[model samples]
Target chain A: MSITPFNIPIVPKLKKETIYSLARKGSRIDKRKLDQFREIKITLGAAGKAHGSALVELGHTKVLAGVKIEPGRPFSDMPDQGVLNVSAEFLPIASSEFEPGPPDENAIEVARVVDRALRESQAIDLGKLAIIPGEKVWVVWVDINVLDHDGNLFDASMLAAMAALLDAKIPQHEILEDGSVRIIGPPIEPLPVKKRVVSVTIGALGNVFLVDPSLEEEAVLDTRIMFSFDEEGNLVGMQKTGAGWLDWDKVAIAFNIARNKYTVPLRALQGAFKS
Target chain B: MSGKKPPFPLLKDGKRHDGRGPMDLRPIQMKVGILHNADGSAWVKMGRTEVIAAAYGPREPPMKAMILPDRAVIRFRYHMAPFSTDERKSPAPSRREIELSKVIREALEATILTHLFPRTVIDVFAEVIQADGGTRTAAITAASLALADAGIPMKGLIAGVAVGKVEGQLVLDIDQVEDEYGEADMPVAAIVGLRKIVLLQLNGVLKPDEFLKALSMAWEGLKRIYELERSVLGSKYKGV
Candidate 1:
């Protein structure tokens, strides 16, 4: 499909060679530790119209997430639970290669990965969102828009979505005598969130595994593996992407590095709420 | 789909719901060059799940803009027939299908020597005729065989499987029942010859140690599938 990424050229040979050579030397182009991540900063309430919103910047990459909660029909299978819809748009404005249109595989991948993290962790207690059992429940929508493309959009978008979900408030509503809901002006109750989760992406180049790659570093990456963890250190989700392969041992190493460094983003999420 | 768990335990004594042990895999069957007019094709059946994969091209790309200077572009799509499931699924591609297509492509790309055929497109389409569970893994196994049948140069073959937790037990080659009721499911694909994992995804909750156990089990499962794939290819070549 045109929505999928195709025909994209690999990074320039010279740059790829330089990165590979540096990796062979156990050094990086940006001089950060192999396991180090770029600086991360998150801003909550970036969108006023949204029930919850966050803007996240990781190095030069920027992502905005907004949450809108509305009373609506629930899925047939999950009649008592709320519906969580996470979508992402990779606007052309973010990068020259990112065309404006429907969401592509990359965007879908991001949204699905983010969605899995939240759902698996039981971050939101969906059963609590029921307005009328099996008929009506709250629908929580998370729309993530990429403003700039640098690298590690996965981590940035998840961070933004989590922060937004945490900051979200549900509108007041009540059931009438006939099970119809009465309208309410503004939201007051916090979403029934029970856990905090963040994902870590580790990009590999031969023997060297780099955490939270930059745009330049990402172009030459052989493969990348990501893991999501809850605040209590429970492993929630895992995904491996890119064209390269990794041995099982290397995956273990990546997992350990992720387990240790995940606190970086979790702390950033907590710090956002404190201030 | 009903989220209600079946009243019976998924596993009793040492037998799973299907009468297999926890480590037992559903029976597998495969055939190569099954479809006409395709450069290469394969049909694979694992348990009740059935999938067919076809590979075409390494020829000129349909769009001039799609030609790359370095390596051939690989386009992949994983689809399920409307009647593949108990319920009639929409023919339109869902987000899950889209994601699976991308992930399966990335996994197969690791084996293809794309640089050998530049400025072209290598197309692979995997269609599921039945959906039992682990269709993506079955599709990967079938696609790899189709590519091999097409005579594409490759570093190695790929085999895929999923290990999941059901009833607090770590089970190999999860089926639809286990997948639906299980607490966690992780699908994995590997280039067993290279001892490298090319594709992996985890959904549901898995502790760290459990993750390692499930991965090791998946690797073991892949090894068996790889052997089956190799023998099938060898038999096909012999018949020709």
Candidate 2:
């Protein structure tokens, strides 16, 4: 869980404040191209102690994701498959309304979006994580901490997680005599990573669609569509959140815009892993 | 700060298990004006624990709670994050948190000039993102800073410090491990005014002599923190 329910800074009613003038002028307050995203900045290995970590700033929205790998007994049901556990923490420093407690619906939805994108895309080669074929495997624990909440946290978290996972490396393990795993040494080889996944969030505002809504934009958005696009521009998963419905034509338009805008950041992720 | 007796008597080596000396305080980092929307806010980092406080409204008080004719109501809510520690915490505040809230409220009420705004409610919300040790103290300190930042009138800035006994020696600012495994943990909220003591809460065992000595240690460290708070506020409100 990331944020508390009582202090959720987002006020849906605040959206009403913008209806009159913006609709009259057919423009946004920030005056950005309708399809343009907020400014983005990504940094890798920010938490030096963690196995892998990255800090992502999508405009004013900031998220830090740290990946920790630990060797432990595999789940009895699926001993062979590795595990990926995602957790989120929404800090109050980001916004005044963030109360402290278990992750609220917003945080849960963010984690679920990132988790589903990772799983459905098969971004991690789980088969290579198996040590003894069916006994031991590497479990990747990704903790995403939301340091600031200016908006578009979902996209920022996904980017941070992906960047951190790419920066992570698992050590070689040997099955012990007591059916336990013994730490041998650093992995002589790197874990196999099949594909890279990233997500882009677009919001619909009064017949106009915008990408990566800012904190102010997020308050007024009626519908938000998060598109998970791979490096090849293939859509892996698309989730429509909130109450508003999107016409089929608008959905198609948003997909194309996401695919096009995604490559710019996707290339940045590749370069981040390279360095 | 290190190089003293151990903080926990039950633990071995006269060494606090968390690797701090008896008189040592945890690493603390504080930043003011973190929240854009709040009138004033602060982020306090005590060891690995992160606590944020925001002050909102001297707005019209909630009608039901406005029975008081002279003084404004100070409403406070203290909450810990679910993933702040190893164990998962429930969403709602527990008995301990509720009690801590009362202690904190009492402490702040004494220092803040609530009578200045009779018909308003000042909201002080403290959210603990991470809980290592001495969270209540940190929250108190942060809340005072937030209130000051919000430009609310007050007698003086209040700073909270804790002094606990370990291995029969007094330690300042107990960490999570020491607080959990030590002999006694005492947390105090001190004001810069002539009345130094505003709130004090102690748990576990301690002799009267030990209690007095621990109280003195807390006051000494608290004086230093109060100066820090003043300097920070001065710099923030310079020329204004």
Candidate No. with top TM-score: 1
Chain A fold similarity by TM-score, each prediction: 0.94, 0.86
Weakest lDDT window of 10 consecutive positions for candidate 1 chain B: B1-10
Candidate 1, DockQ to 2 decimals?
A: 0.62
How well is each residue in B64-102 modelled by candidate 2, as lDDT tens digits? Answer: 545355657777877888887778999687645765665
Stretches of candidate 1 exceeding 4 Å from the true structure: A1-10, A24-26, B1-4
The DockQ of each candidate is 0.62, 0.01
Q: Give the CAPRI class of candidate 1.
A: medium
Candidate 1 residue-wise lDDT, B1-240, digit = tens = 123576678988988889998788899999999999889999999999999999997888888888777788888899999999999999999999989998988887888999998888899999999999999999999999999999988889999999988887899999888888887889999888989999999988888899888888998899999999999999998977
iRMSD computed for candidate 1: 2.5
lDDT winner: 1
Residue A190 in candidate 1 has what lDDT?
A: 95
The alpha-carbon lDDT assigned to residue A151 of candidate 2 equals: 80
- Give me the chain B TM-score of candidate 1: 0.97
- lDDT of model number 2: 0.72
